[model samples]
Target: MKPKFITISDSIIKKIKSGELIPGDKIPSENELIKNYKISNTTARKTLLEIESKGWVRRIKGKGTFVLNRTATHQLVRTLGSIDSTRKGFNESLKAEGLTPKNIILEKTILNEGVSAAIVGRHVIIEGPVLKVHQLRYADDELMKDETRYISLTLCPKIDALSTEISYFKAYEQQYNLKINDIRQTLSADILEANSNKNHFGTTSNIAIFVLDSAVFADDGKVIEIEYSYYRGDKYKFAISAHPEYGHKSDD
Candidate 1:
């Protein structure tokens, strides 16, 4: 049997979903919940805490709990280099959500010195000459993602000449006739902070964000590209799947 607090919490969540409870609408107070369900005051408080932790509601001192505002799930699980390596990933995700996706080229330069040289030395197959590109992604004109990519000039020299809207994966396969072997990434939750794009993203009040670091490999087991992306936590909820039986397999 489920815990009494969980059962009560489900009941409250049902009300929120059915529109019986709405955002900014006060839910039952702890005392009221105790009276309504014949549960103890402790059980009632536990129920409230459970729902709040799940992002269903918020508690204001002396003001009771109120349903939290929510929107459609904008879950992004893939990258520009899709698992299958054939799809236009980031754009497709936005279109599926009924939002127009736009990308802006903030900067694209040949990296020969400074920190770019260090990054190139560590990841790119070539000893030097990396093409670094900075891009901003938008959902219906709202800035939603910030991306920086580094490409080995020795691997795909045309990468620097491609249009801003072109997909790097397409260039790798179609233009260069090279097959992608795998894509690896690491994701973590973080806060948006002072950076070069702070003006584009505005204040750090909405601090919740996700940082993703990725590397793309070629068929010959050479690392050709590296990427860093930041997704707005307030706007996106990501869903990732794990297959333990697969046991550390790369996307084929």
Candidate 2:
């Protein structure tokens, strides 16, 4: 037999999909649901928890539970490395949602442009020439992001000669015996368009909020690669840990 909470959860999910319940709209409270569905309070509360876990709704302590204002399922944990490596991290982040990360390399080239101020002290591969690589990332085949990376071939010679079978980071290790020391990152909102042979983003084609940028440093603290990525805005959200700012103290 179906569990009482599971049945109620399904009913709520149905209403959400049917447009009867819109984003930010509050559904019946736990007490109301218990009386209306003839279920116990435990079942009512359990149903709400289920929906919240699915990221379909939010429980505002003093306010109430309401549908989530979300468009697509995009959850990213920032990590530094090659496309393959990032995909691995993405897969883990989306695992609970039953989603898998996938990608298609769109282009790879040698060029000399596109470095920004934030990465100034670090060598910009563009100052001379670099290996610029582009790829489209997907979650379970749903287009999720576009990545553009710039790597300094001057410092890591033979980098462009590496086999495509291995990840760029691993290739760097094999070719230059280098290791990652730290990573710097930034996030922002943007939009995407279907370009080249990439159309997996779907026709709706809305603006996206991307992780924006990142800089990876070799063990010696020299920047080896800088990447800028665009993510589907409707499907992405950012989470940051907060800390209180400390003010200057008087000299003792």
Candidate 3:
């Protein structure tokens, strides 16, 4: 049989999972736990400690124990068409939830042919150089994703001079009048240690992340851009769909 303290902790956790106890709400005090669960003071203290260790609740010196605001899941629907579809979807979803979407340019540089080929793919030939731009994306002021996009300067010349504040896809469509044909993408998940580069995400070490890699093609069947993106796993969920008529198997 499980210990009384373990049972008590589990019950509290159920309340949290059911949304009966929300973040910032104070949990049962030691005395209250002892009276309610008929457990000893030692058991009550142990239960609180166990909960705190699990990152569910935090105890303040004089303010009592309060539930931590756990991560909420945001769903991302993948669309097969358009160049800026994903970006536009993200912005719209956040706005629908009353959250403001923002992006910060972290770094921008020109990569030589060798480095560009190695990063993107050998099949993607770079005539001259590639412009790589790194960005941090946020929702409601909380960092949500990190992205690195490589653009072929041969295709979008003077792209480095464009403002990072605007969407690259929109800029490509409006300024250059380029039509995007398709985007091939892959998704994976991994745990990343908190490094200086990830500090803006406000996450600790060993955080789970969702990775997305995509190659955008122009109307002429030329690869124009490659993008690598990392999203906080705790904050986002993705749904993928396939159309059999489009040569995509539903089982895929």
Candidate 4:
């Protein structure tokens, strides 16, 4: 049998999906849940927390839990570390959620002056000049991601000459004959003030943000690019499937 908390959370989710529990609707209080479902207080609290973590409701201090504008606060989920998935999965997730996804190149430049052998074994795995491309990504017209890519010109000569709409991965495969092997990445969370120095998102401030630092490598064990992407926490979420080999063991 499924865990009681999961069952309760799923029931609430079903109500929300059916439009019975909608935006701004206060969900049942912990006491109400305990009374209605005959569950313990701990289970009731877990149920509510699970729902909140799923981005379905907001709990105001002493005011009960209420629904949110899912369209605005809806979390676009992207699967991470999936061998079968690519950056294309991100756009696909947005479209599946009834959102329109787009990206604009904020800047693209060459970094010849700073090309040095020292950075090869460190930040970048490639040994020559780099092309930096800064972008702002949007979903449903809301600022979602501020991304910057540093590509190895050594691996992709004249890549900067390509159109802004070209997919770098496709270019690697077709133009450079380099197949992507794996991407090493690290994800962390932080808060960004509305007046961030970058000013990437004008409408939101003091919001949660996710920082993704990654290196893209090719089949030959050479790094193709390095990237730093900041994703709006309210606009996105990440999912990953892991077997025992990759899963983190619980301390408990």
Candidate 4 clash pair list: 194-205
How much lDDT does each candidate structure score? 0.68, 0.62, 0.69, 0.71
Candidate 4 — what's its lDDT? 0.71
Shift in Å, residue 140, candidate 2:
1.4
TM-score of 4: 0.61
* TM-score for each of the candidates: 0.58, 0.50, 0.58, 0.61
Measured by lDDT, the strongest candidate is: 4
Best by TM-score: 4
The list of candidate 4 runs beyond 4 A from truth reads 1-72, 87-97, 113-123, 243-252
Tell me each candidate's RMSD, in Å, in order: 13.7, 11.9, 14.4, 12.2
Tens digit of per-residue lDDT, candidate 1, span 57-99: 8776664676665655443334322443223456544553345
lDDT of 3 at 124: 52
The residue-by-residue lDDT of candidate 4 on 75-184, one tens digit each, is 65555564334443345434434456787889999887433221223454556588988988787778888988888998999999986556676678789988777666
**For model 1, which pairs clash?**
none
lDDT of 3 by residue, 55-127 (tens): 7887777757877655554333334333334444455434434356787888899887623332223355444
